[model samples]
Target: MIRSAYSHPVAEVEITELSAVPLNVVELLSKAHHPKAGAVVLFSGEVRNNNNGKEVAYLDYEAHQIMAAKMIRTILDDANKKWPLNIAIAQHRTGKVTVGETAVVVITASAHRSEAYQANQYIIDRIKHEALIWKCEYFTDGSHQWGGNCSCH
Candidate 1:
């Protein structure tokens, strides 16, 4: 998941993960809703218990706030240039999160379904790959490993 704490004008993206995800993603989509916006796309990333052969106890996501927000905004800018988007909202959780919890959410509103679809994919992909977020897996065996810190996982 990506770290939250961003404020932008193009997108009203207030994110909180302090007591688990506090807002509804559907609500965020509704904010982007408009008569002209015919389509809205949403994505949710959840915590899992297992990765590969190891049992994951939980996950710790860390990020540089300024850099992450900048990267996300940049990705959104690029996506809007390619897709006719009306509004976009993306959020990812940080700190320790357990199983079955929501770790991230992305919502994209557009004039057409195609634009929403492509923009949704682009936003999530860019956020996961370039948002300066690092995830450490706390294993059931009391061991831990990190991912998304470097090119080599």
Candidate 2:
């Protein structure tokens, strides 16, 4: 959505069509890189084996896909406003995600390291806080819990 040519050297909002397919962090990182950019920061969120004290079997993610994409774009826009980023991308997965599989990936590119790193973190944090995506964790012992309802902080 950033109209400025300099603001958006590369920008994308992606929601995986095949839930079984893993997030490709390398591809996102490559897309974020630009000749003018000195720094490219990437973040990948993966499904862990355990949450709290429970042993997680797999994660089920759900979202109003259209709304989630909109929210992600908005978060990217906010990052653009706060930083001098040349490129930004944020992606998330839906349906079942098993342990060790990537659930989300975010990338940011800028002329400086500070802005790239800061904006990358900001984008992911905002997505977690504001995006409509929800996750349900299925434990190995036949227990389940809503992930969005809980926060680390």
TM-score of each: 0.80, 0.86
Candidate 2 lDDT by residue in tens digits, 54-127: 89999999888778877887788788888988888778888899999889888888899999999999998888
* Residue runs of model 2 more than 4 Å from their true location after superposition: 1-20, 148-153
Candidate with best TM-score: 2
- In model 1, the runs with Cα more than 4 Å from the true position are 1-23, 148-152
Global CA lDDT computed for model 2: 0.78
lDDT of 1 by residue, 1-153 (tens): 222233322444454322234336667566667566788888888878888788889888888877776777677667767776767777777788887777777888877898899899988888888788788988999999889223434
Task: Compute the lDDT for candidate 1.
Answer: 0.71
- Candidate 2 to truth, TM: 0.86
Backbone Cα, N, C clashes tallied per candidate: 0, 0
Task: Name the 10 consecutive residues with the lowest summed lDDT in model 1.
Answer: 1-10
Give the Å shift of residue 73 in candidate 2: 0.5
Instruction: Tell me the whole-model lDDT of each prediction, alpha carbons only.
Output: 0.71, 0.78
